[model samples]
Target: MTLSVRRARTNDVPSIHQLLDYYAARGQLLPRSPDELTEHISSFTVINEADNLTGCAALEVFTEDLGEVRSLAVRDAATGGGYGRALVEEIEHNARTIGLRRLMALTYVPDFFARLGYGVVAMNTLPEKVFGVCVTCPKFRCCDEIAVLKHLD
Candidate 1:
């Protein structure tokens, strides 16, 4: 079967949460509540290969000109299978469709994003994210995730 990214469905919540939780448990990502996931499910996308969930991501709009690539995770077994790249491409397409000029991500895998045309950026440059969301994170003062940005065309 062909693998493609699709809008997330409510039924995908459990699997999405499990995939995200796997990363969160290792501090690679922040934990997301099921309620939050359900509430913003419309912002998410998923990749299912032959009925097995391979990966997921969400495009979180931060402002009229900016959007974020959040909750990006690929199943352990699918790490090298291009699922992550596919999800990011879908998020980029969605962001451009919505008229967003920039897409940013705070990622542990900067190289992965860089390969997708994203450039490393200083966290302070994104005040909207730094003040709006990152401030409340437990790792606020010590956040280690690399910030990357891609200007959408």
Candidate 2:
């Protein structure tokens, strides 16, 4: 199946929420409410095939030089089809277009990020990330998610 990655529209919010909810429920990522999705809707990209949402990802800017890839998820039926990679590439493209120097993710799939040119880094090194969101996580003191970053420059 051919997939196209595009900037998400307001109408796509429900699909994005559902995709994130699927993975979040399985402990792969954090669950985001529709309100939160609306707040950051502009940061998102969705992969669609013939009008069907196949996957989605978002890039949340933390600073002029840094951004975080969040809420990345691919439908179970869409795995191994490069939808995830395409979504990340789309996010990277946006990051570069906006002049960001780095892109990061807190993920369980370190190998996937590594394949996309990201390197694993210590969570402690990312103060902006830790203080901004990690602090509010229930797993803050014992987080197992790995920090990975890719230089965009």
lDDT of 1 at 115: 91
In model 1, which regions exceed 4 Å deviation? none
Local distance difference test, candidate 2 = 0.92
Q: Candidate 2 — which residues are off by over 4 angstroms?
A: none
Global lDDT for candidate 1? 0.94
Task: Give the lowest summed-lDDT range of ten residues in model 1.
Answer: 77-86
Q: Which lDDT tens digits does candidate 1 get at residues 1-153?
A: 888689999989999999999999999999999999999999999999888789999999999999999999999987998888899999999999999999999999999999999999999999999999998999999899999999998
lDDT of 2 by residue, 1-153 (tens): 566889999999999898889888899999999999998899999999989999999999988899999999999988998888999999999999999999999999999999999999998888989999788989999899999999998
Q: How close to the true structure is residue 82 of candidate 1, measured as C-alpha lDDT? A: 81
Q: All models: lDDT?
A: 0.94, 0.92
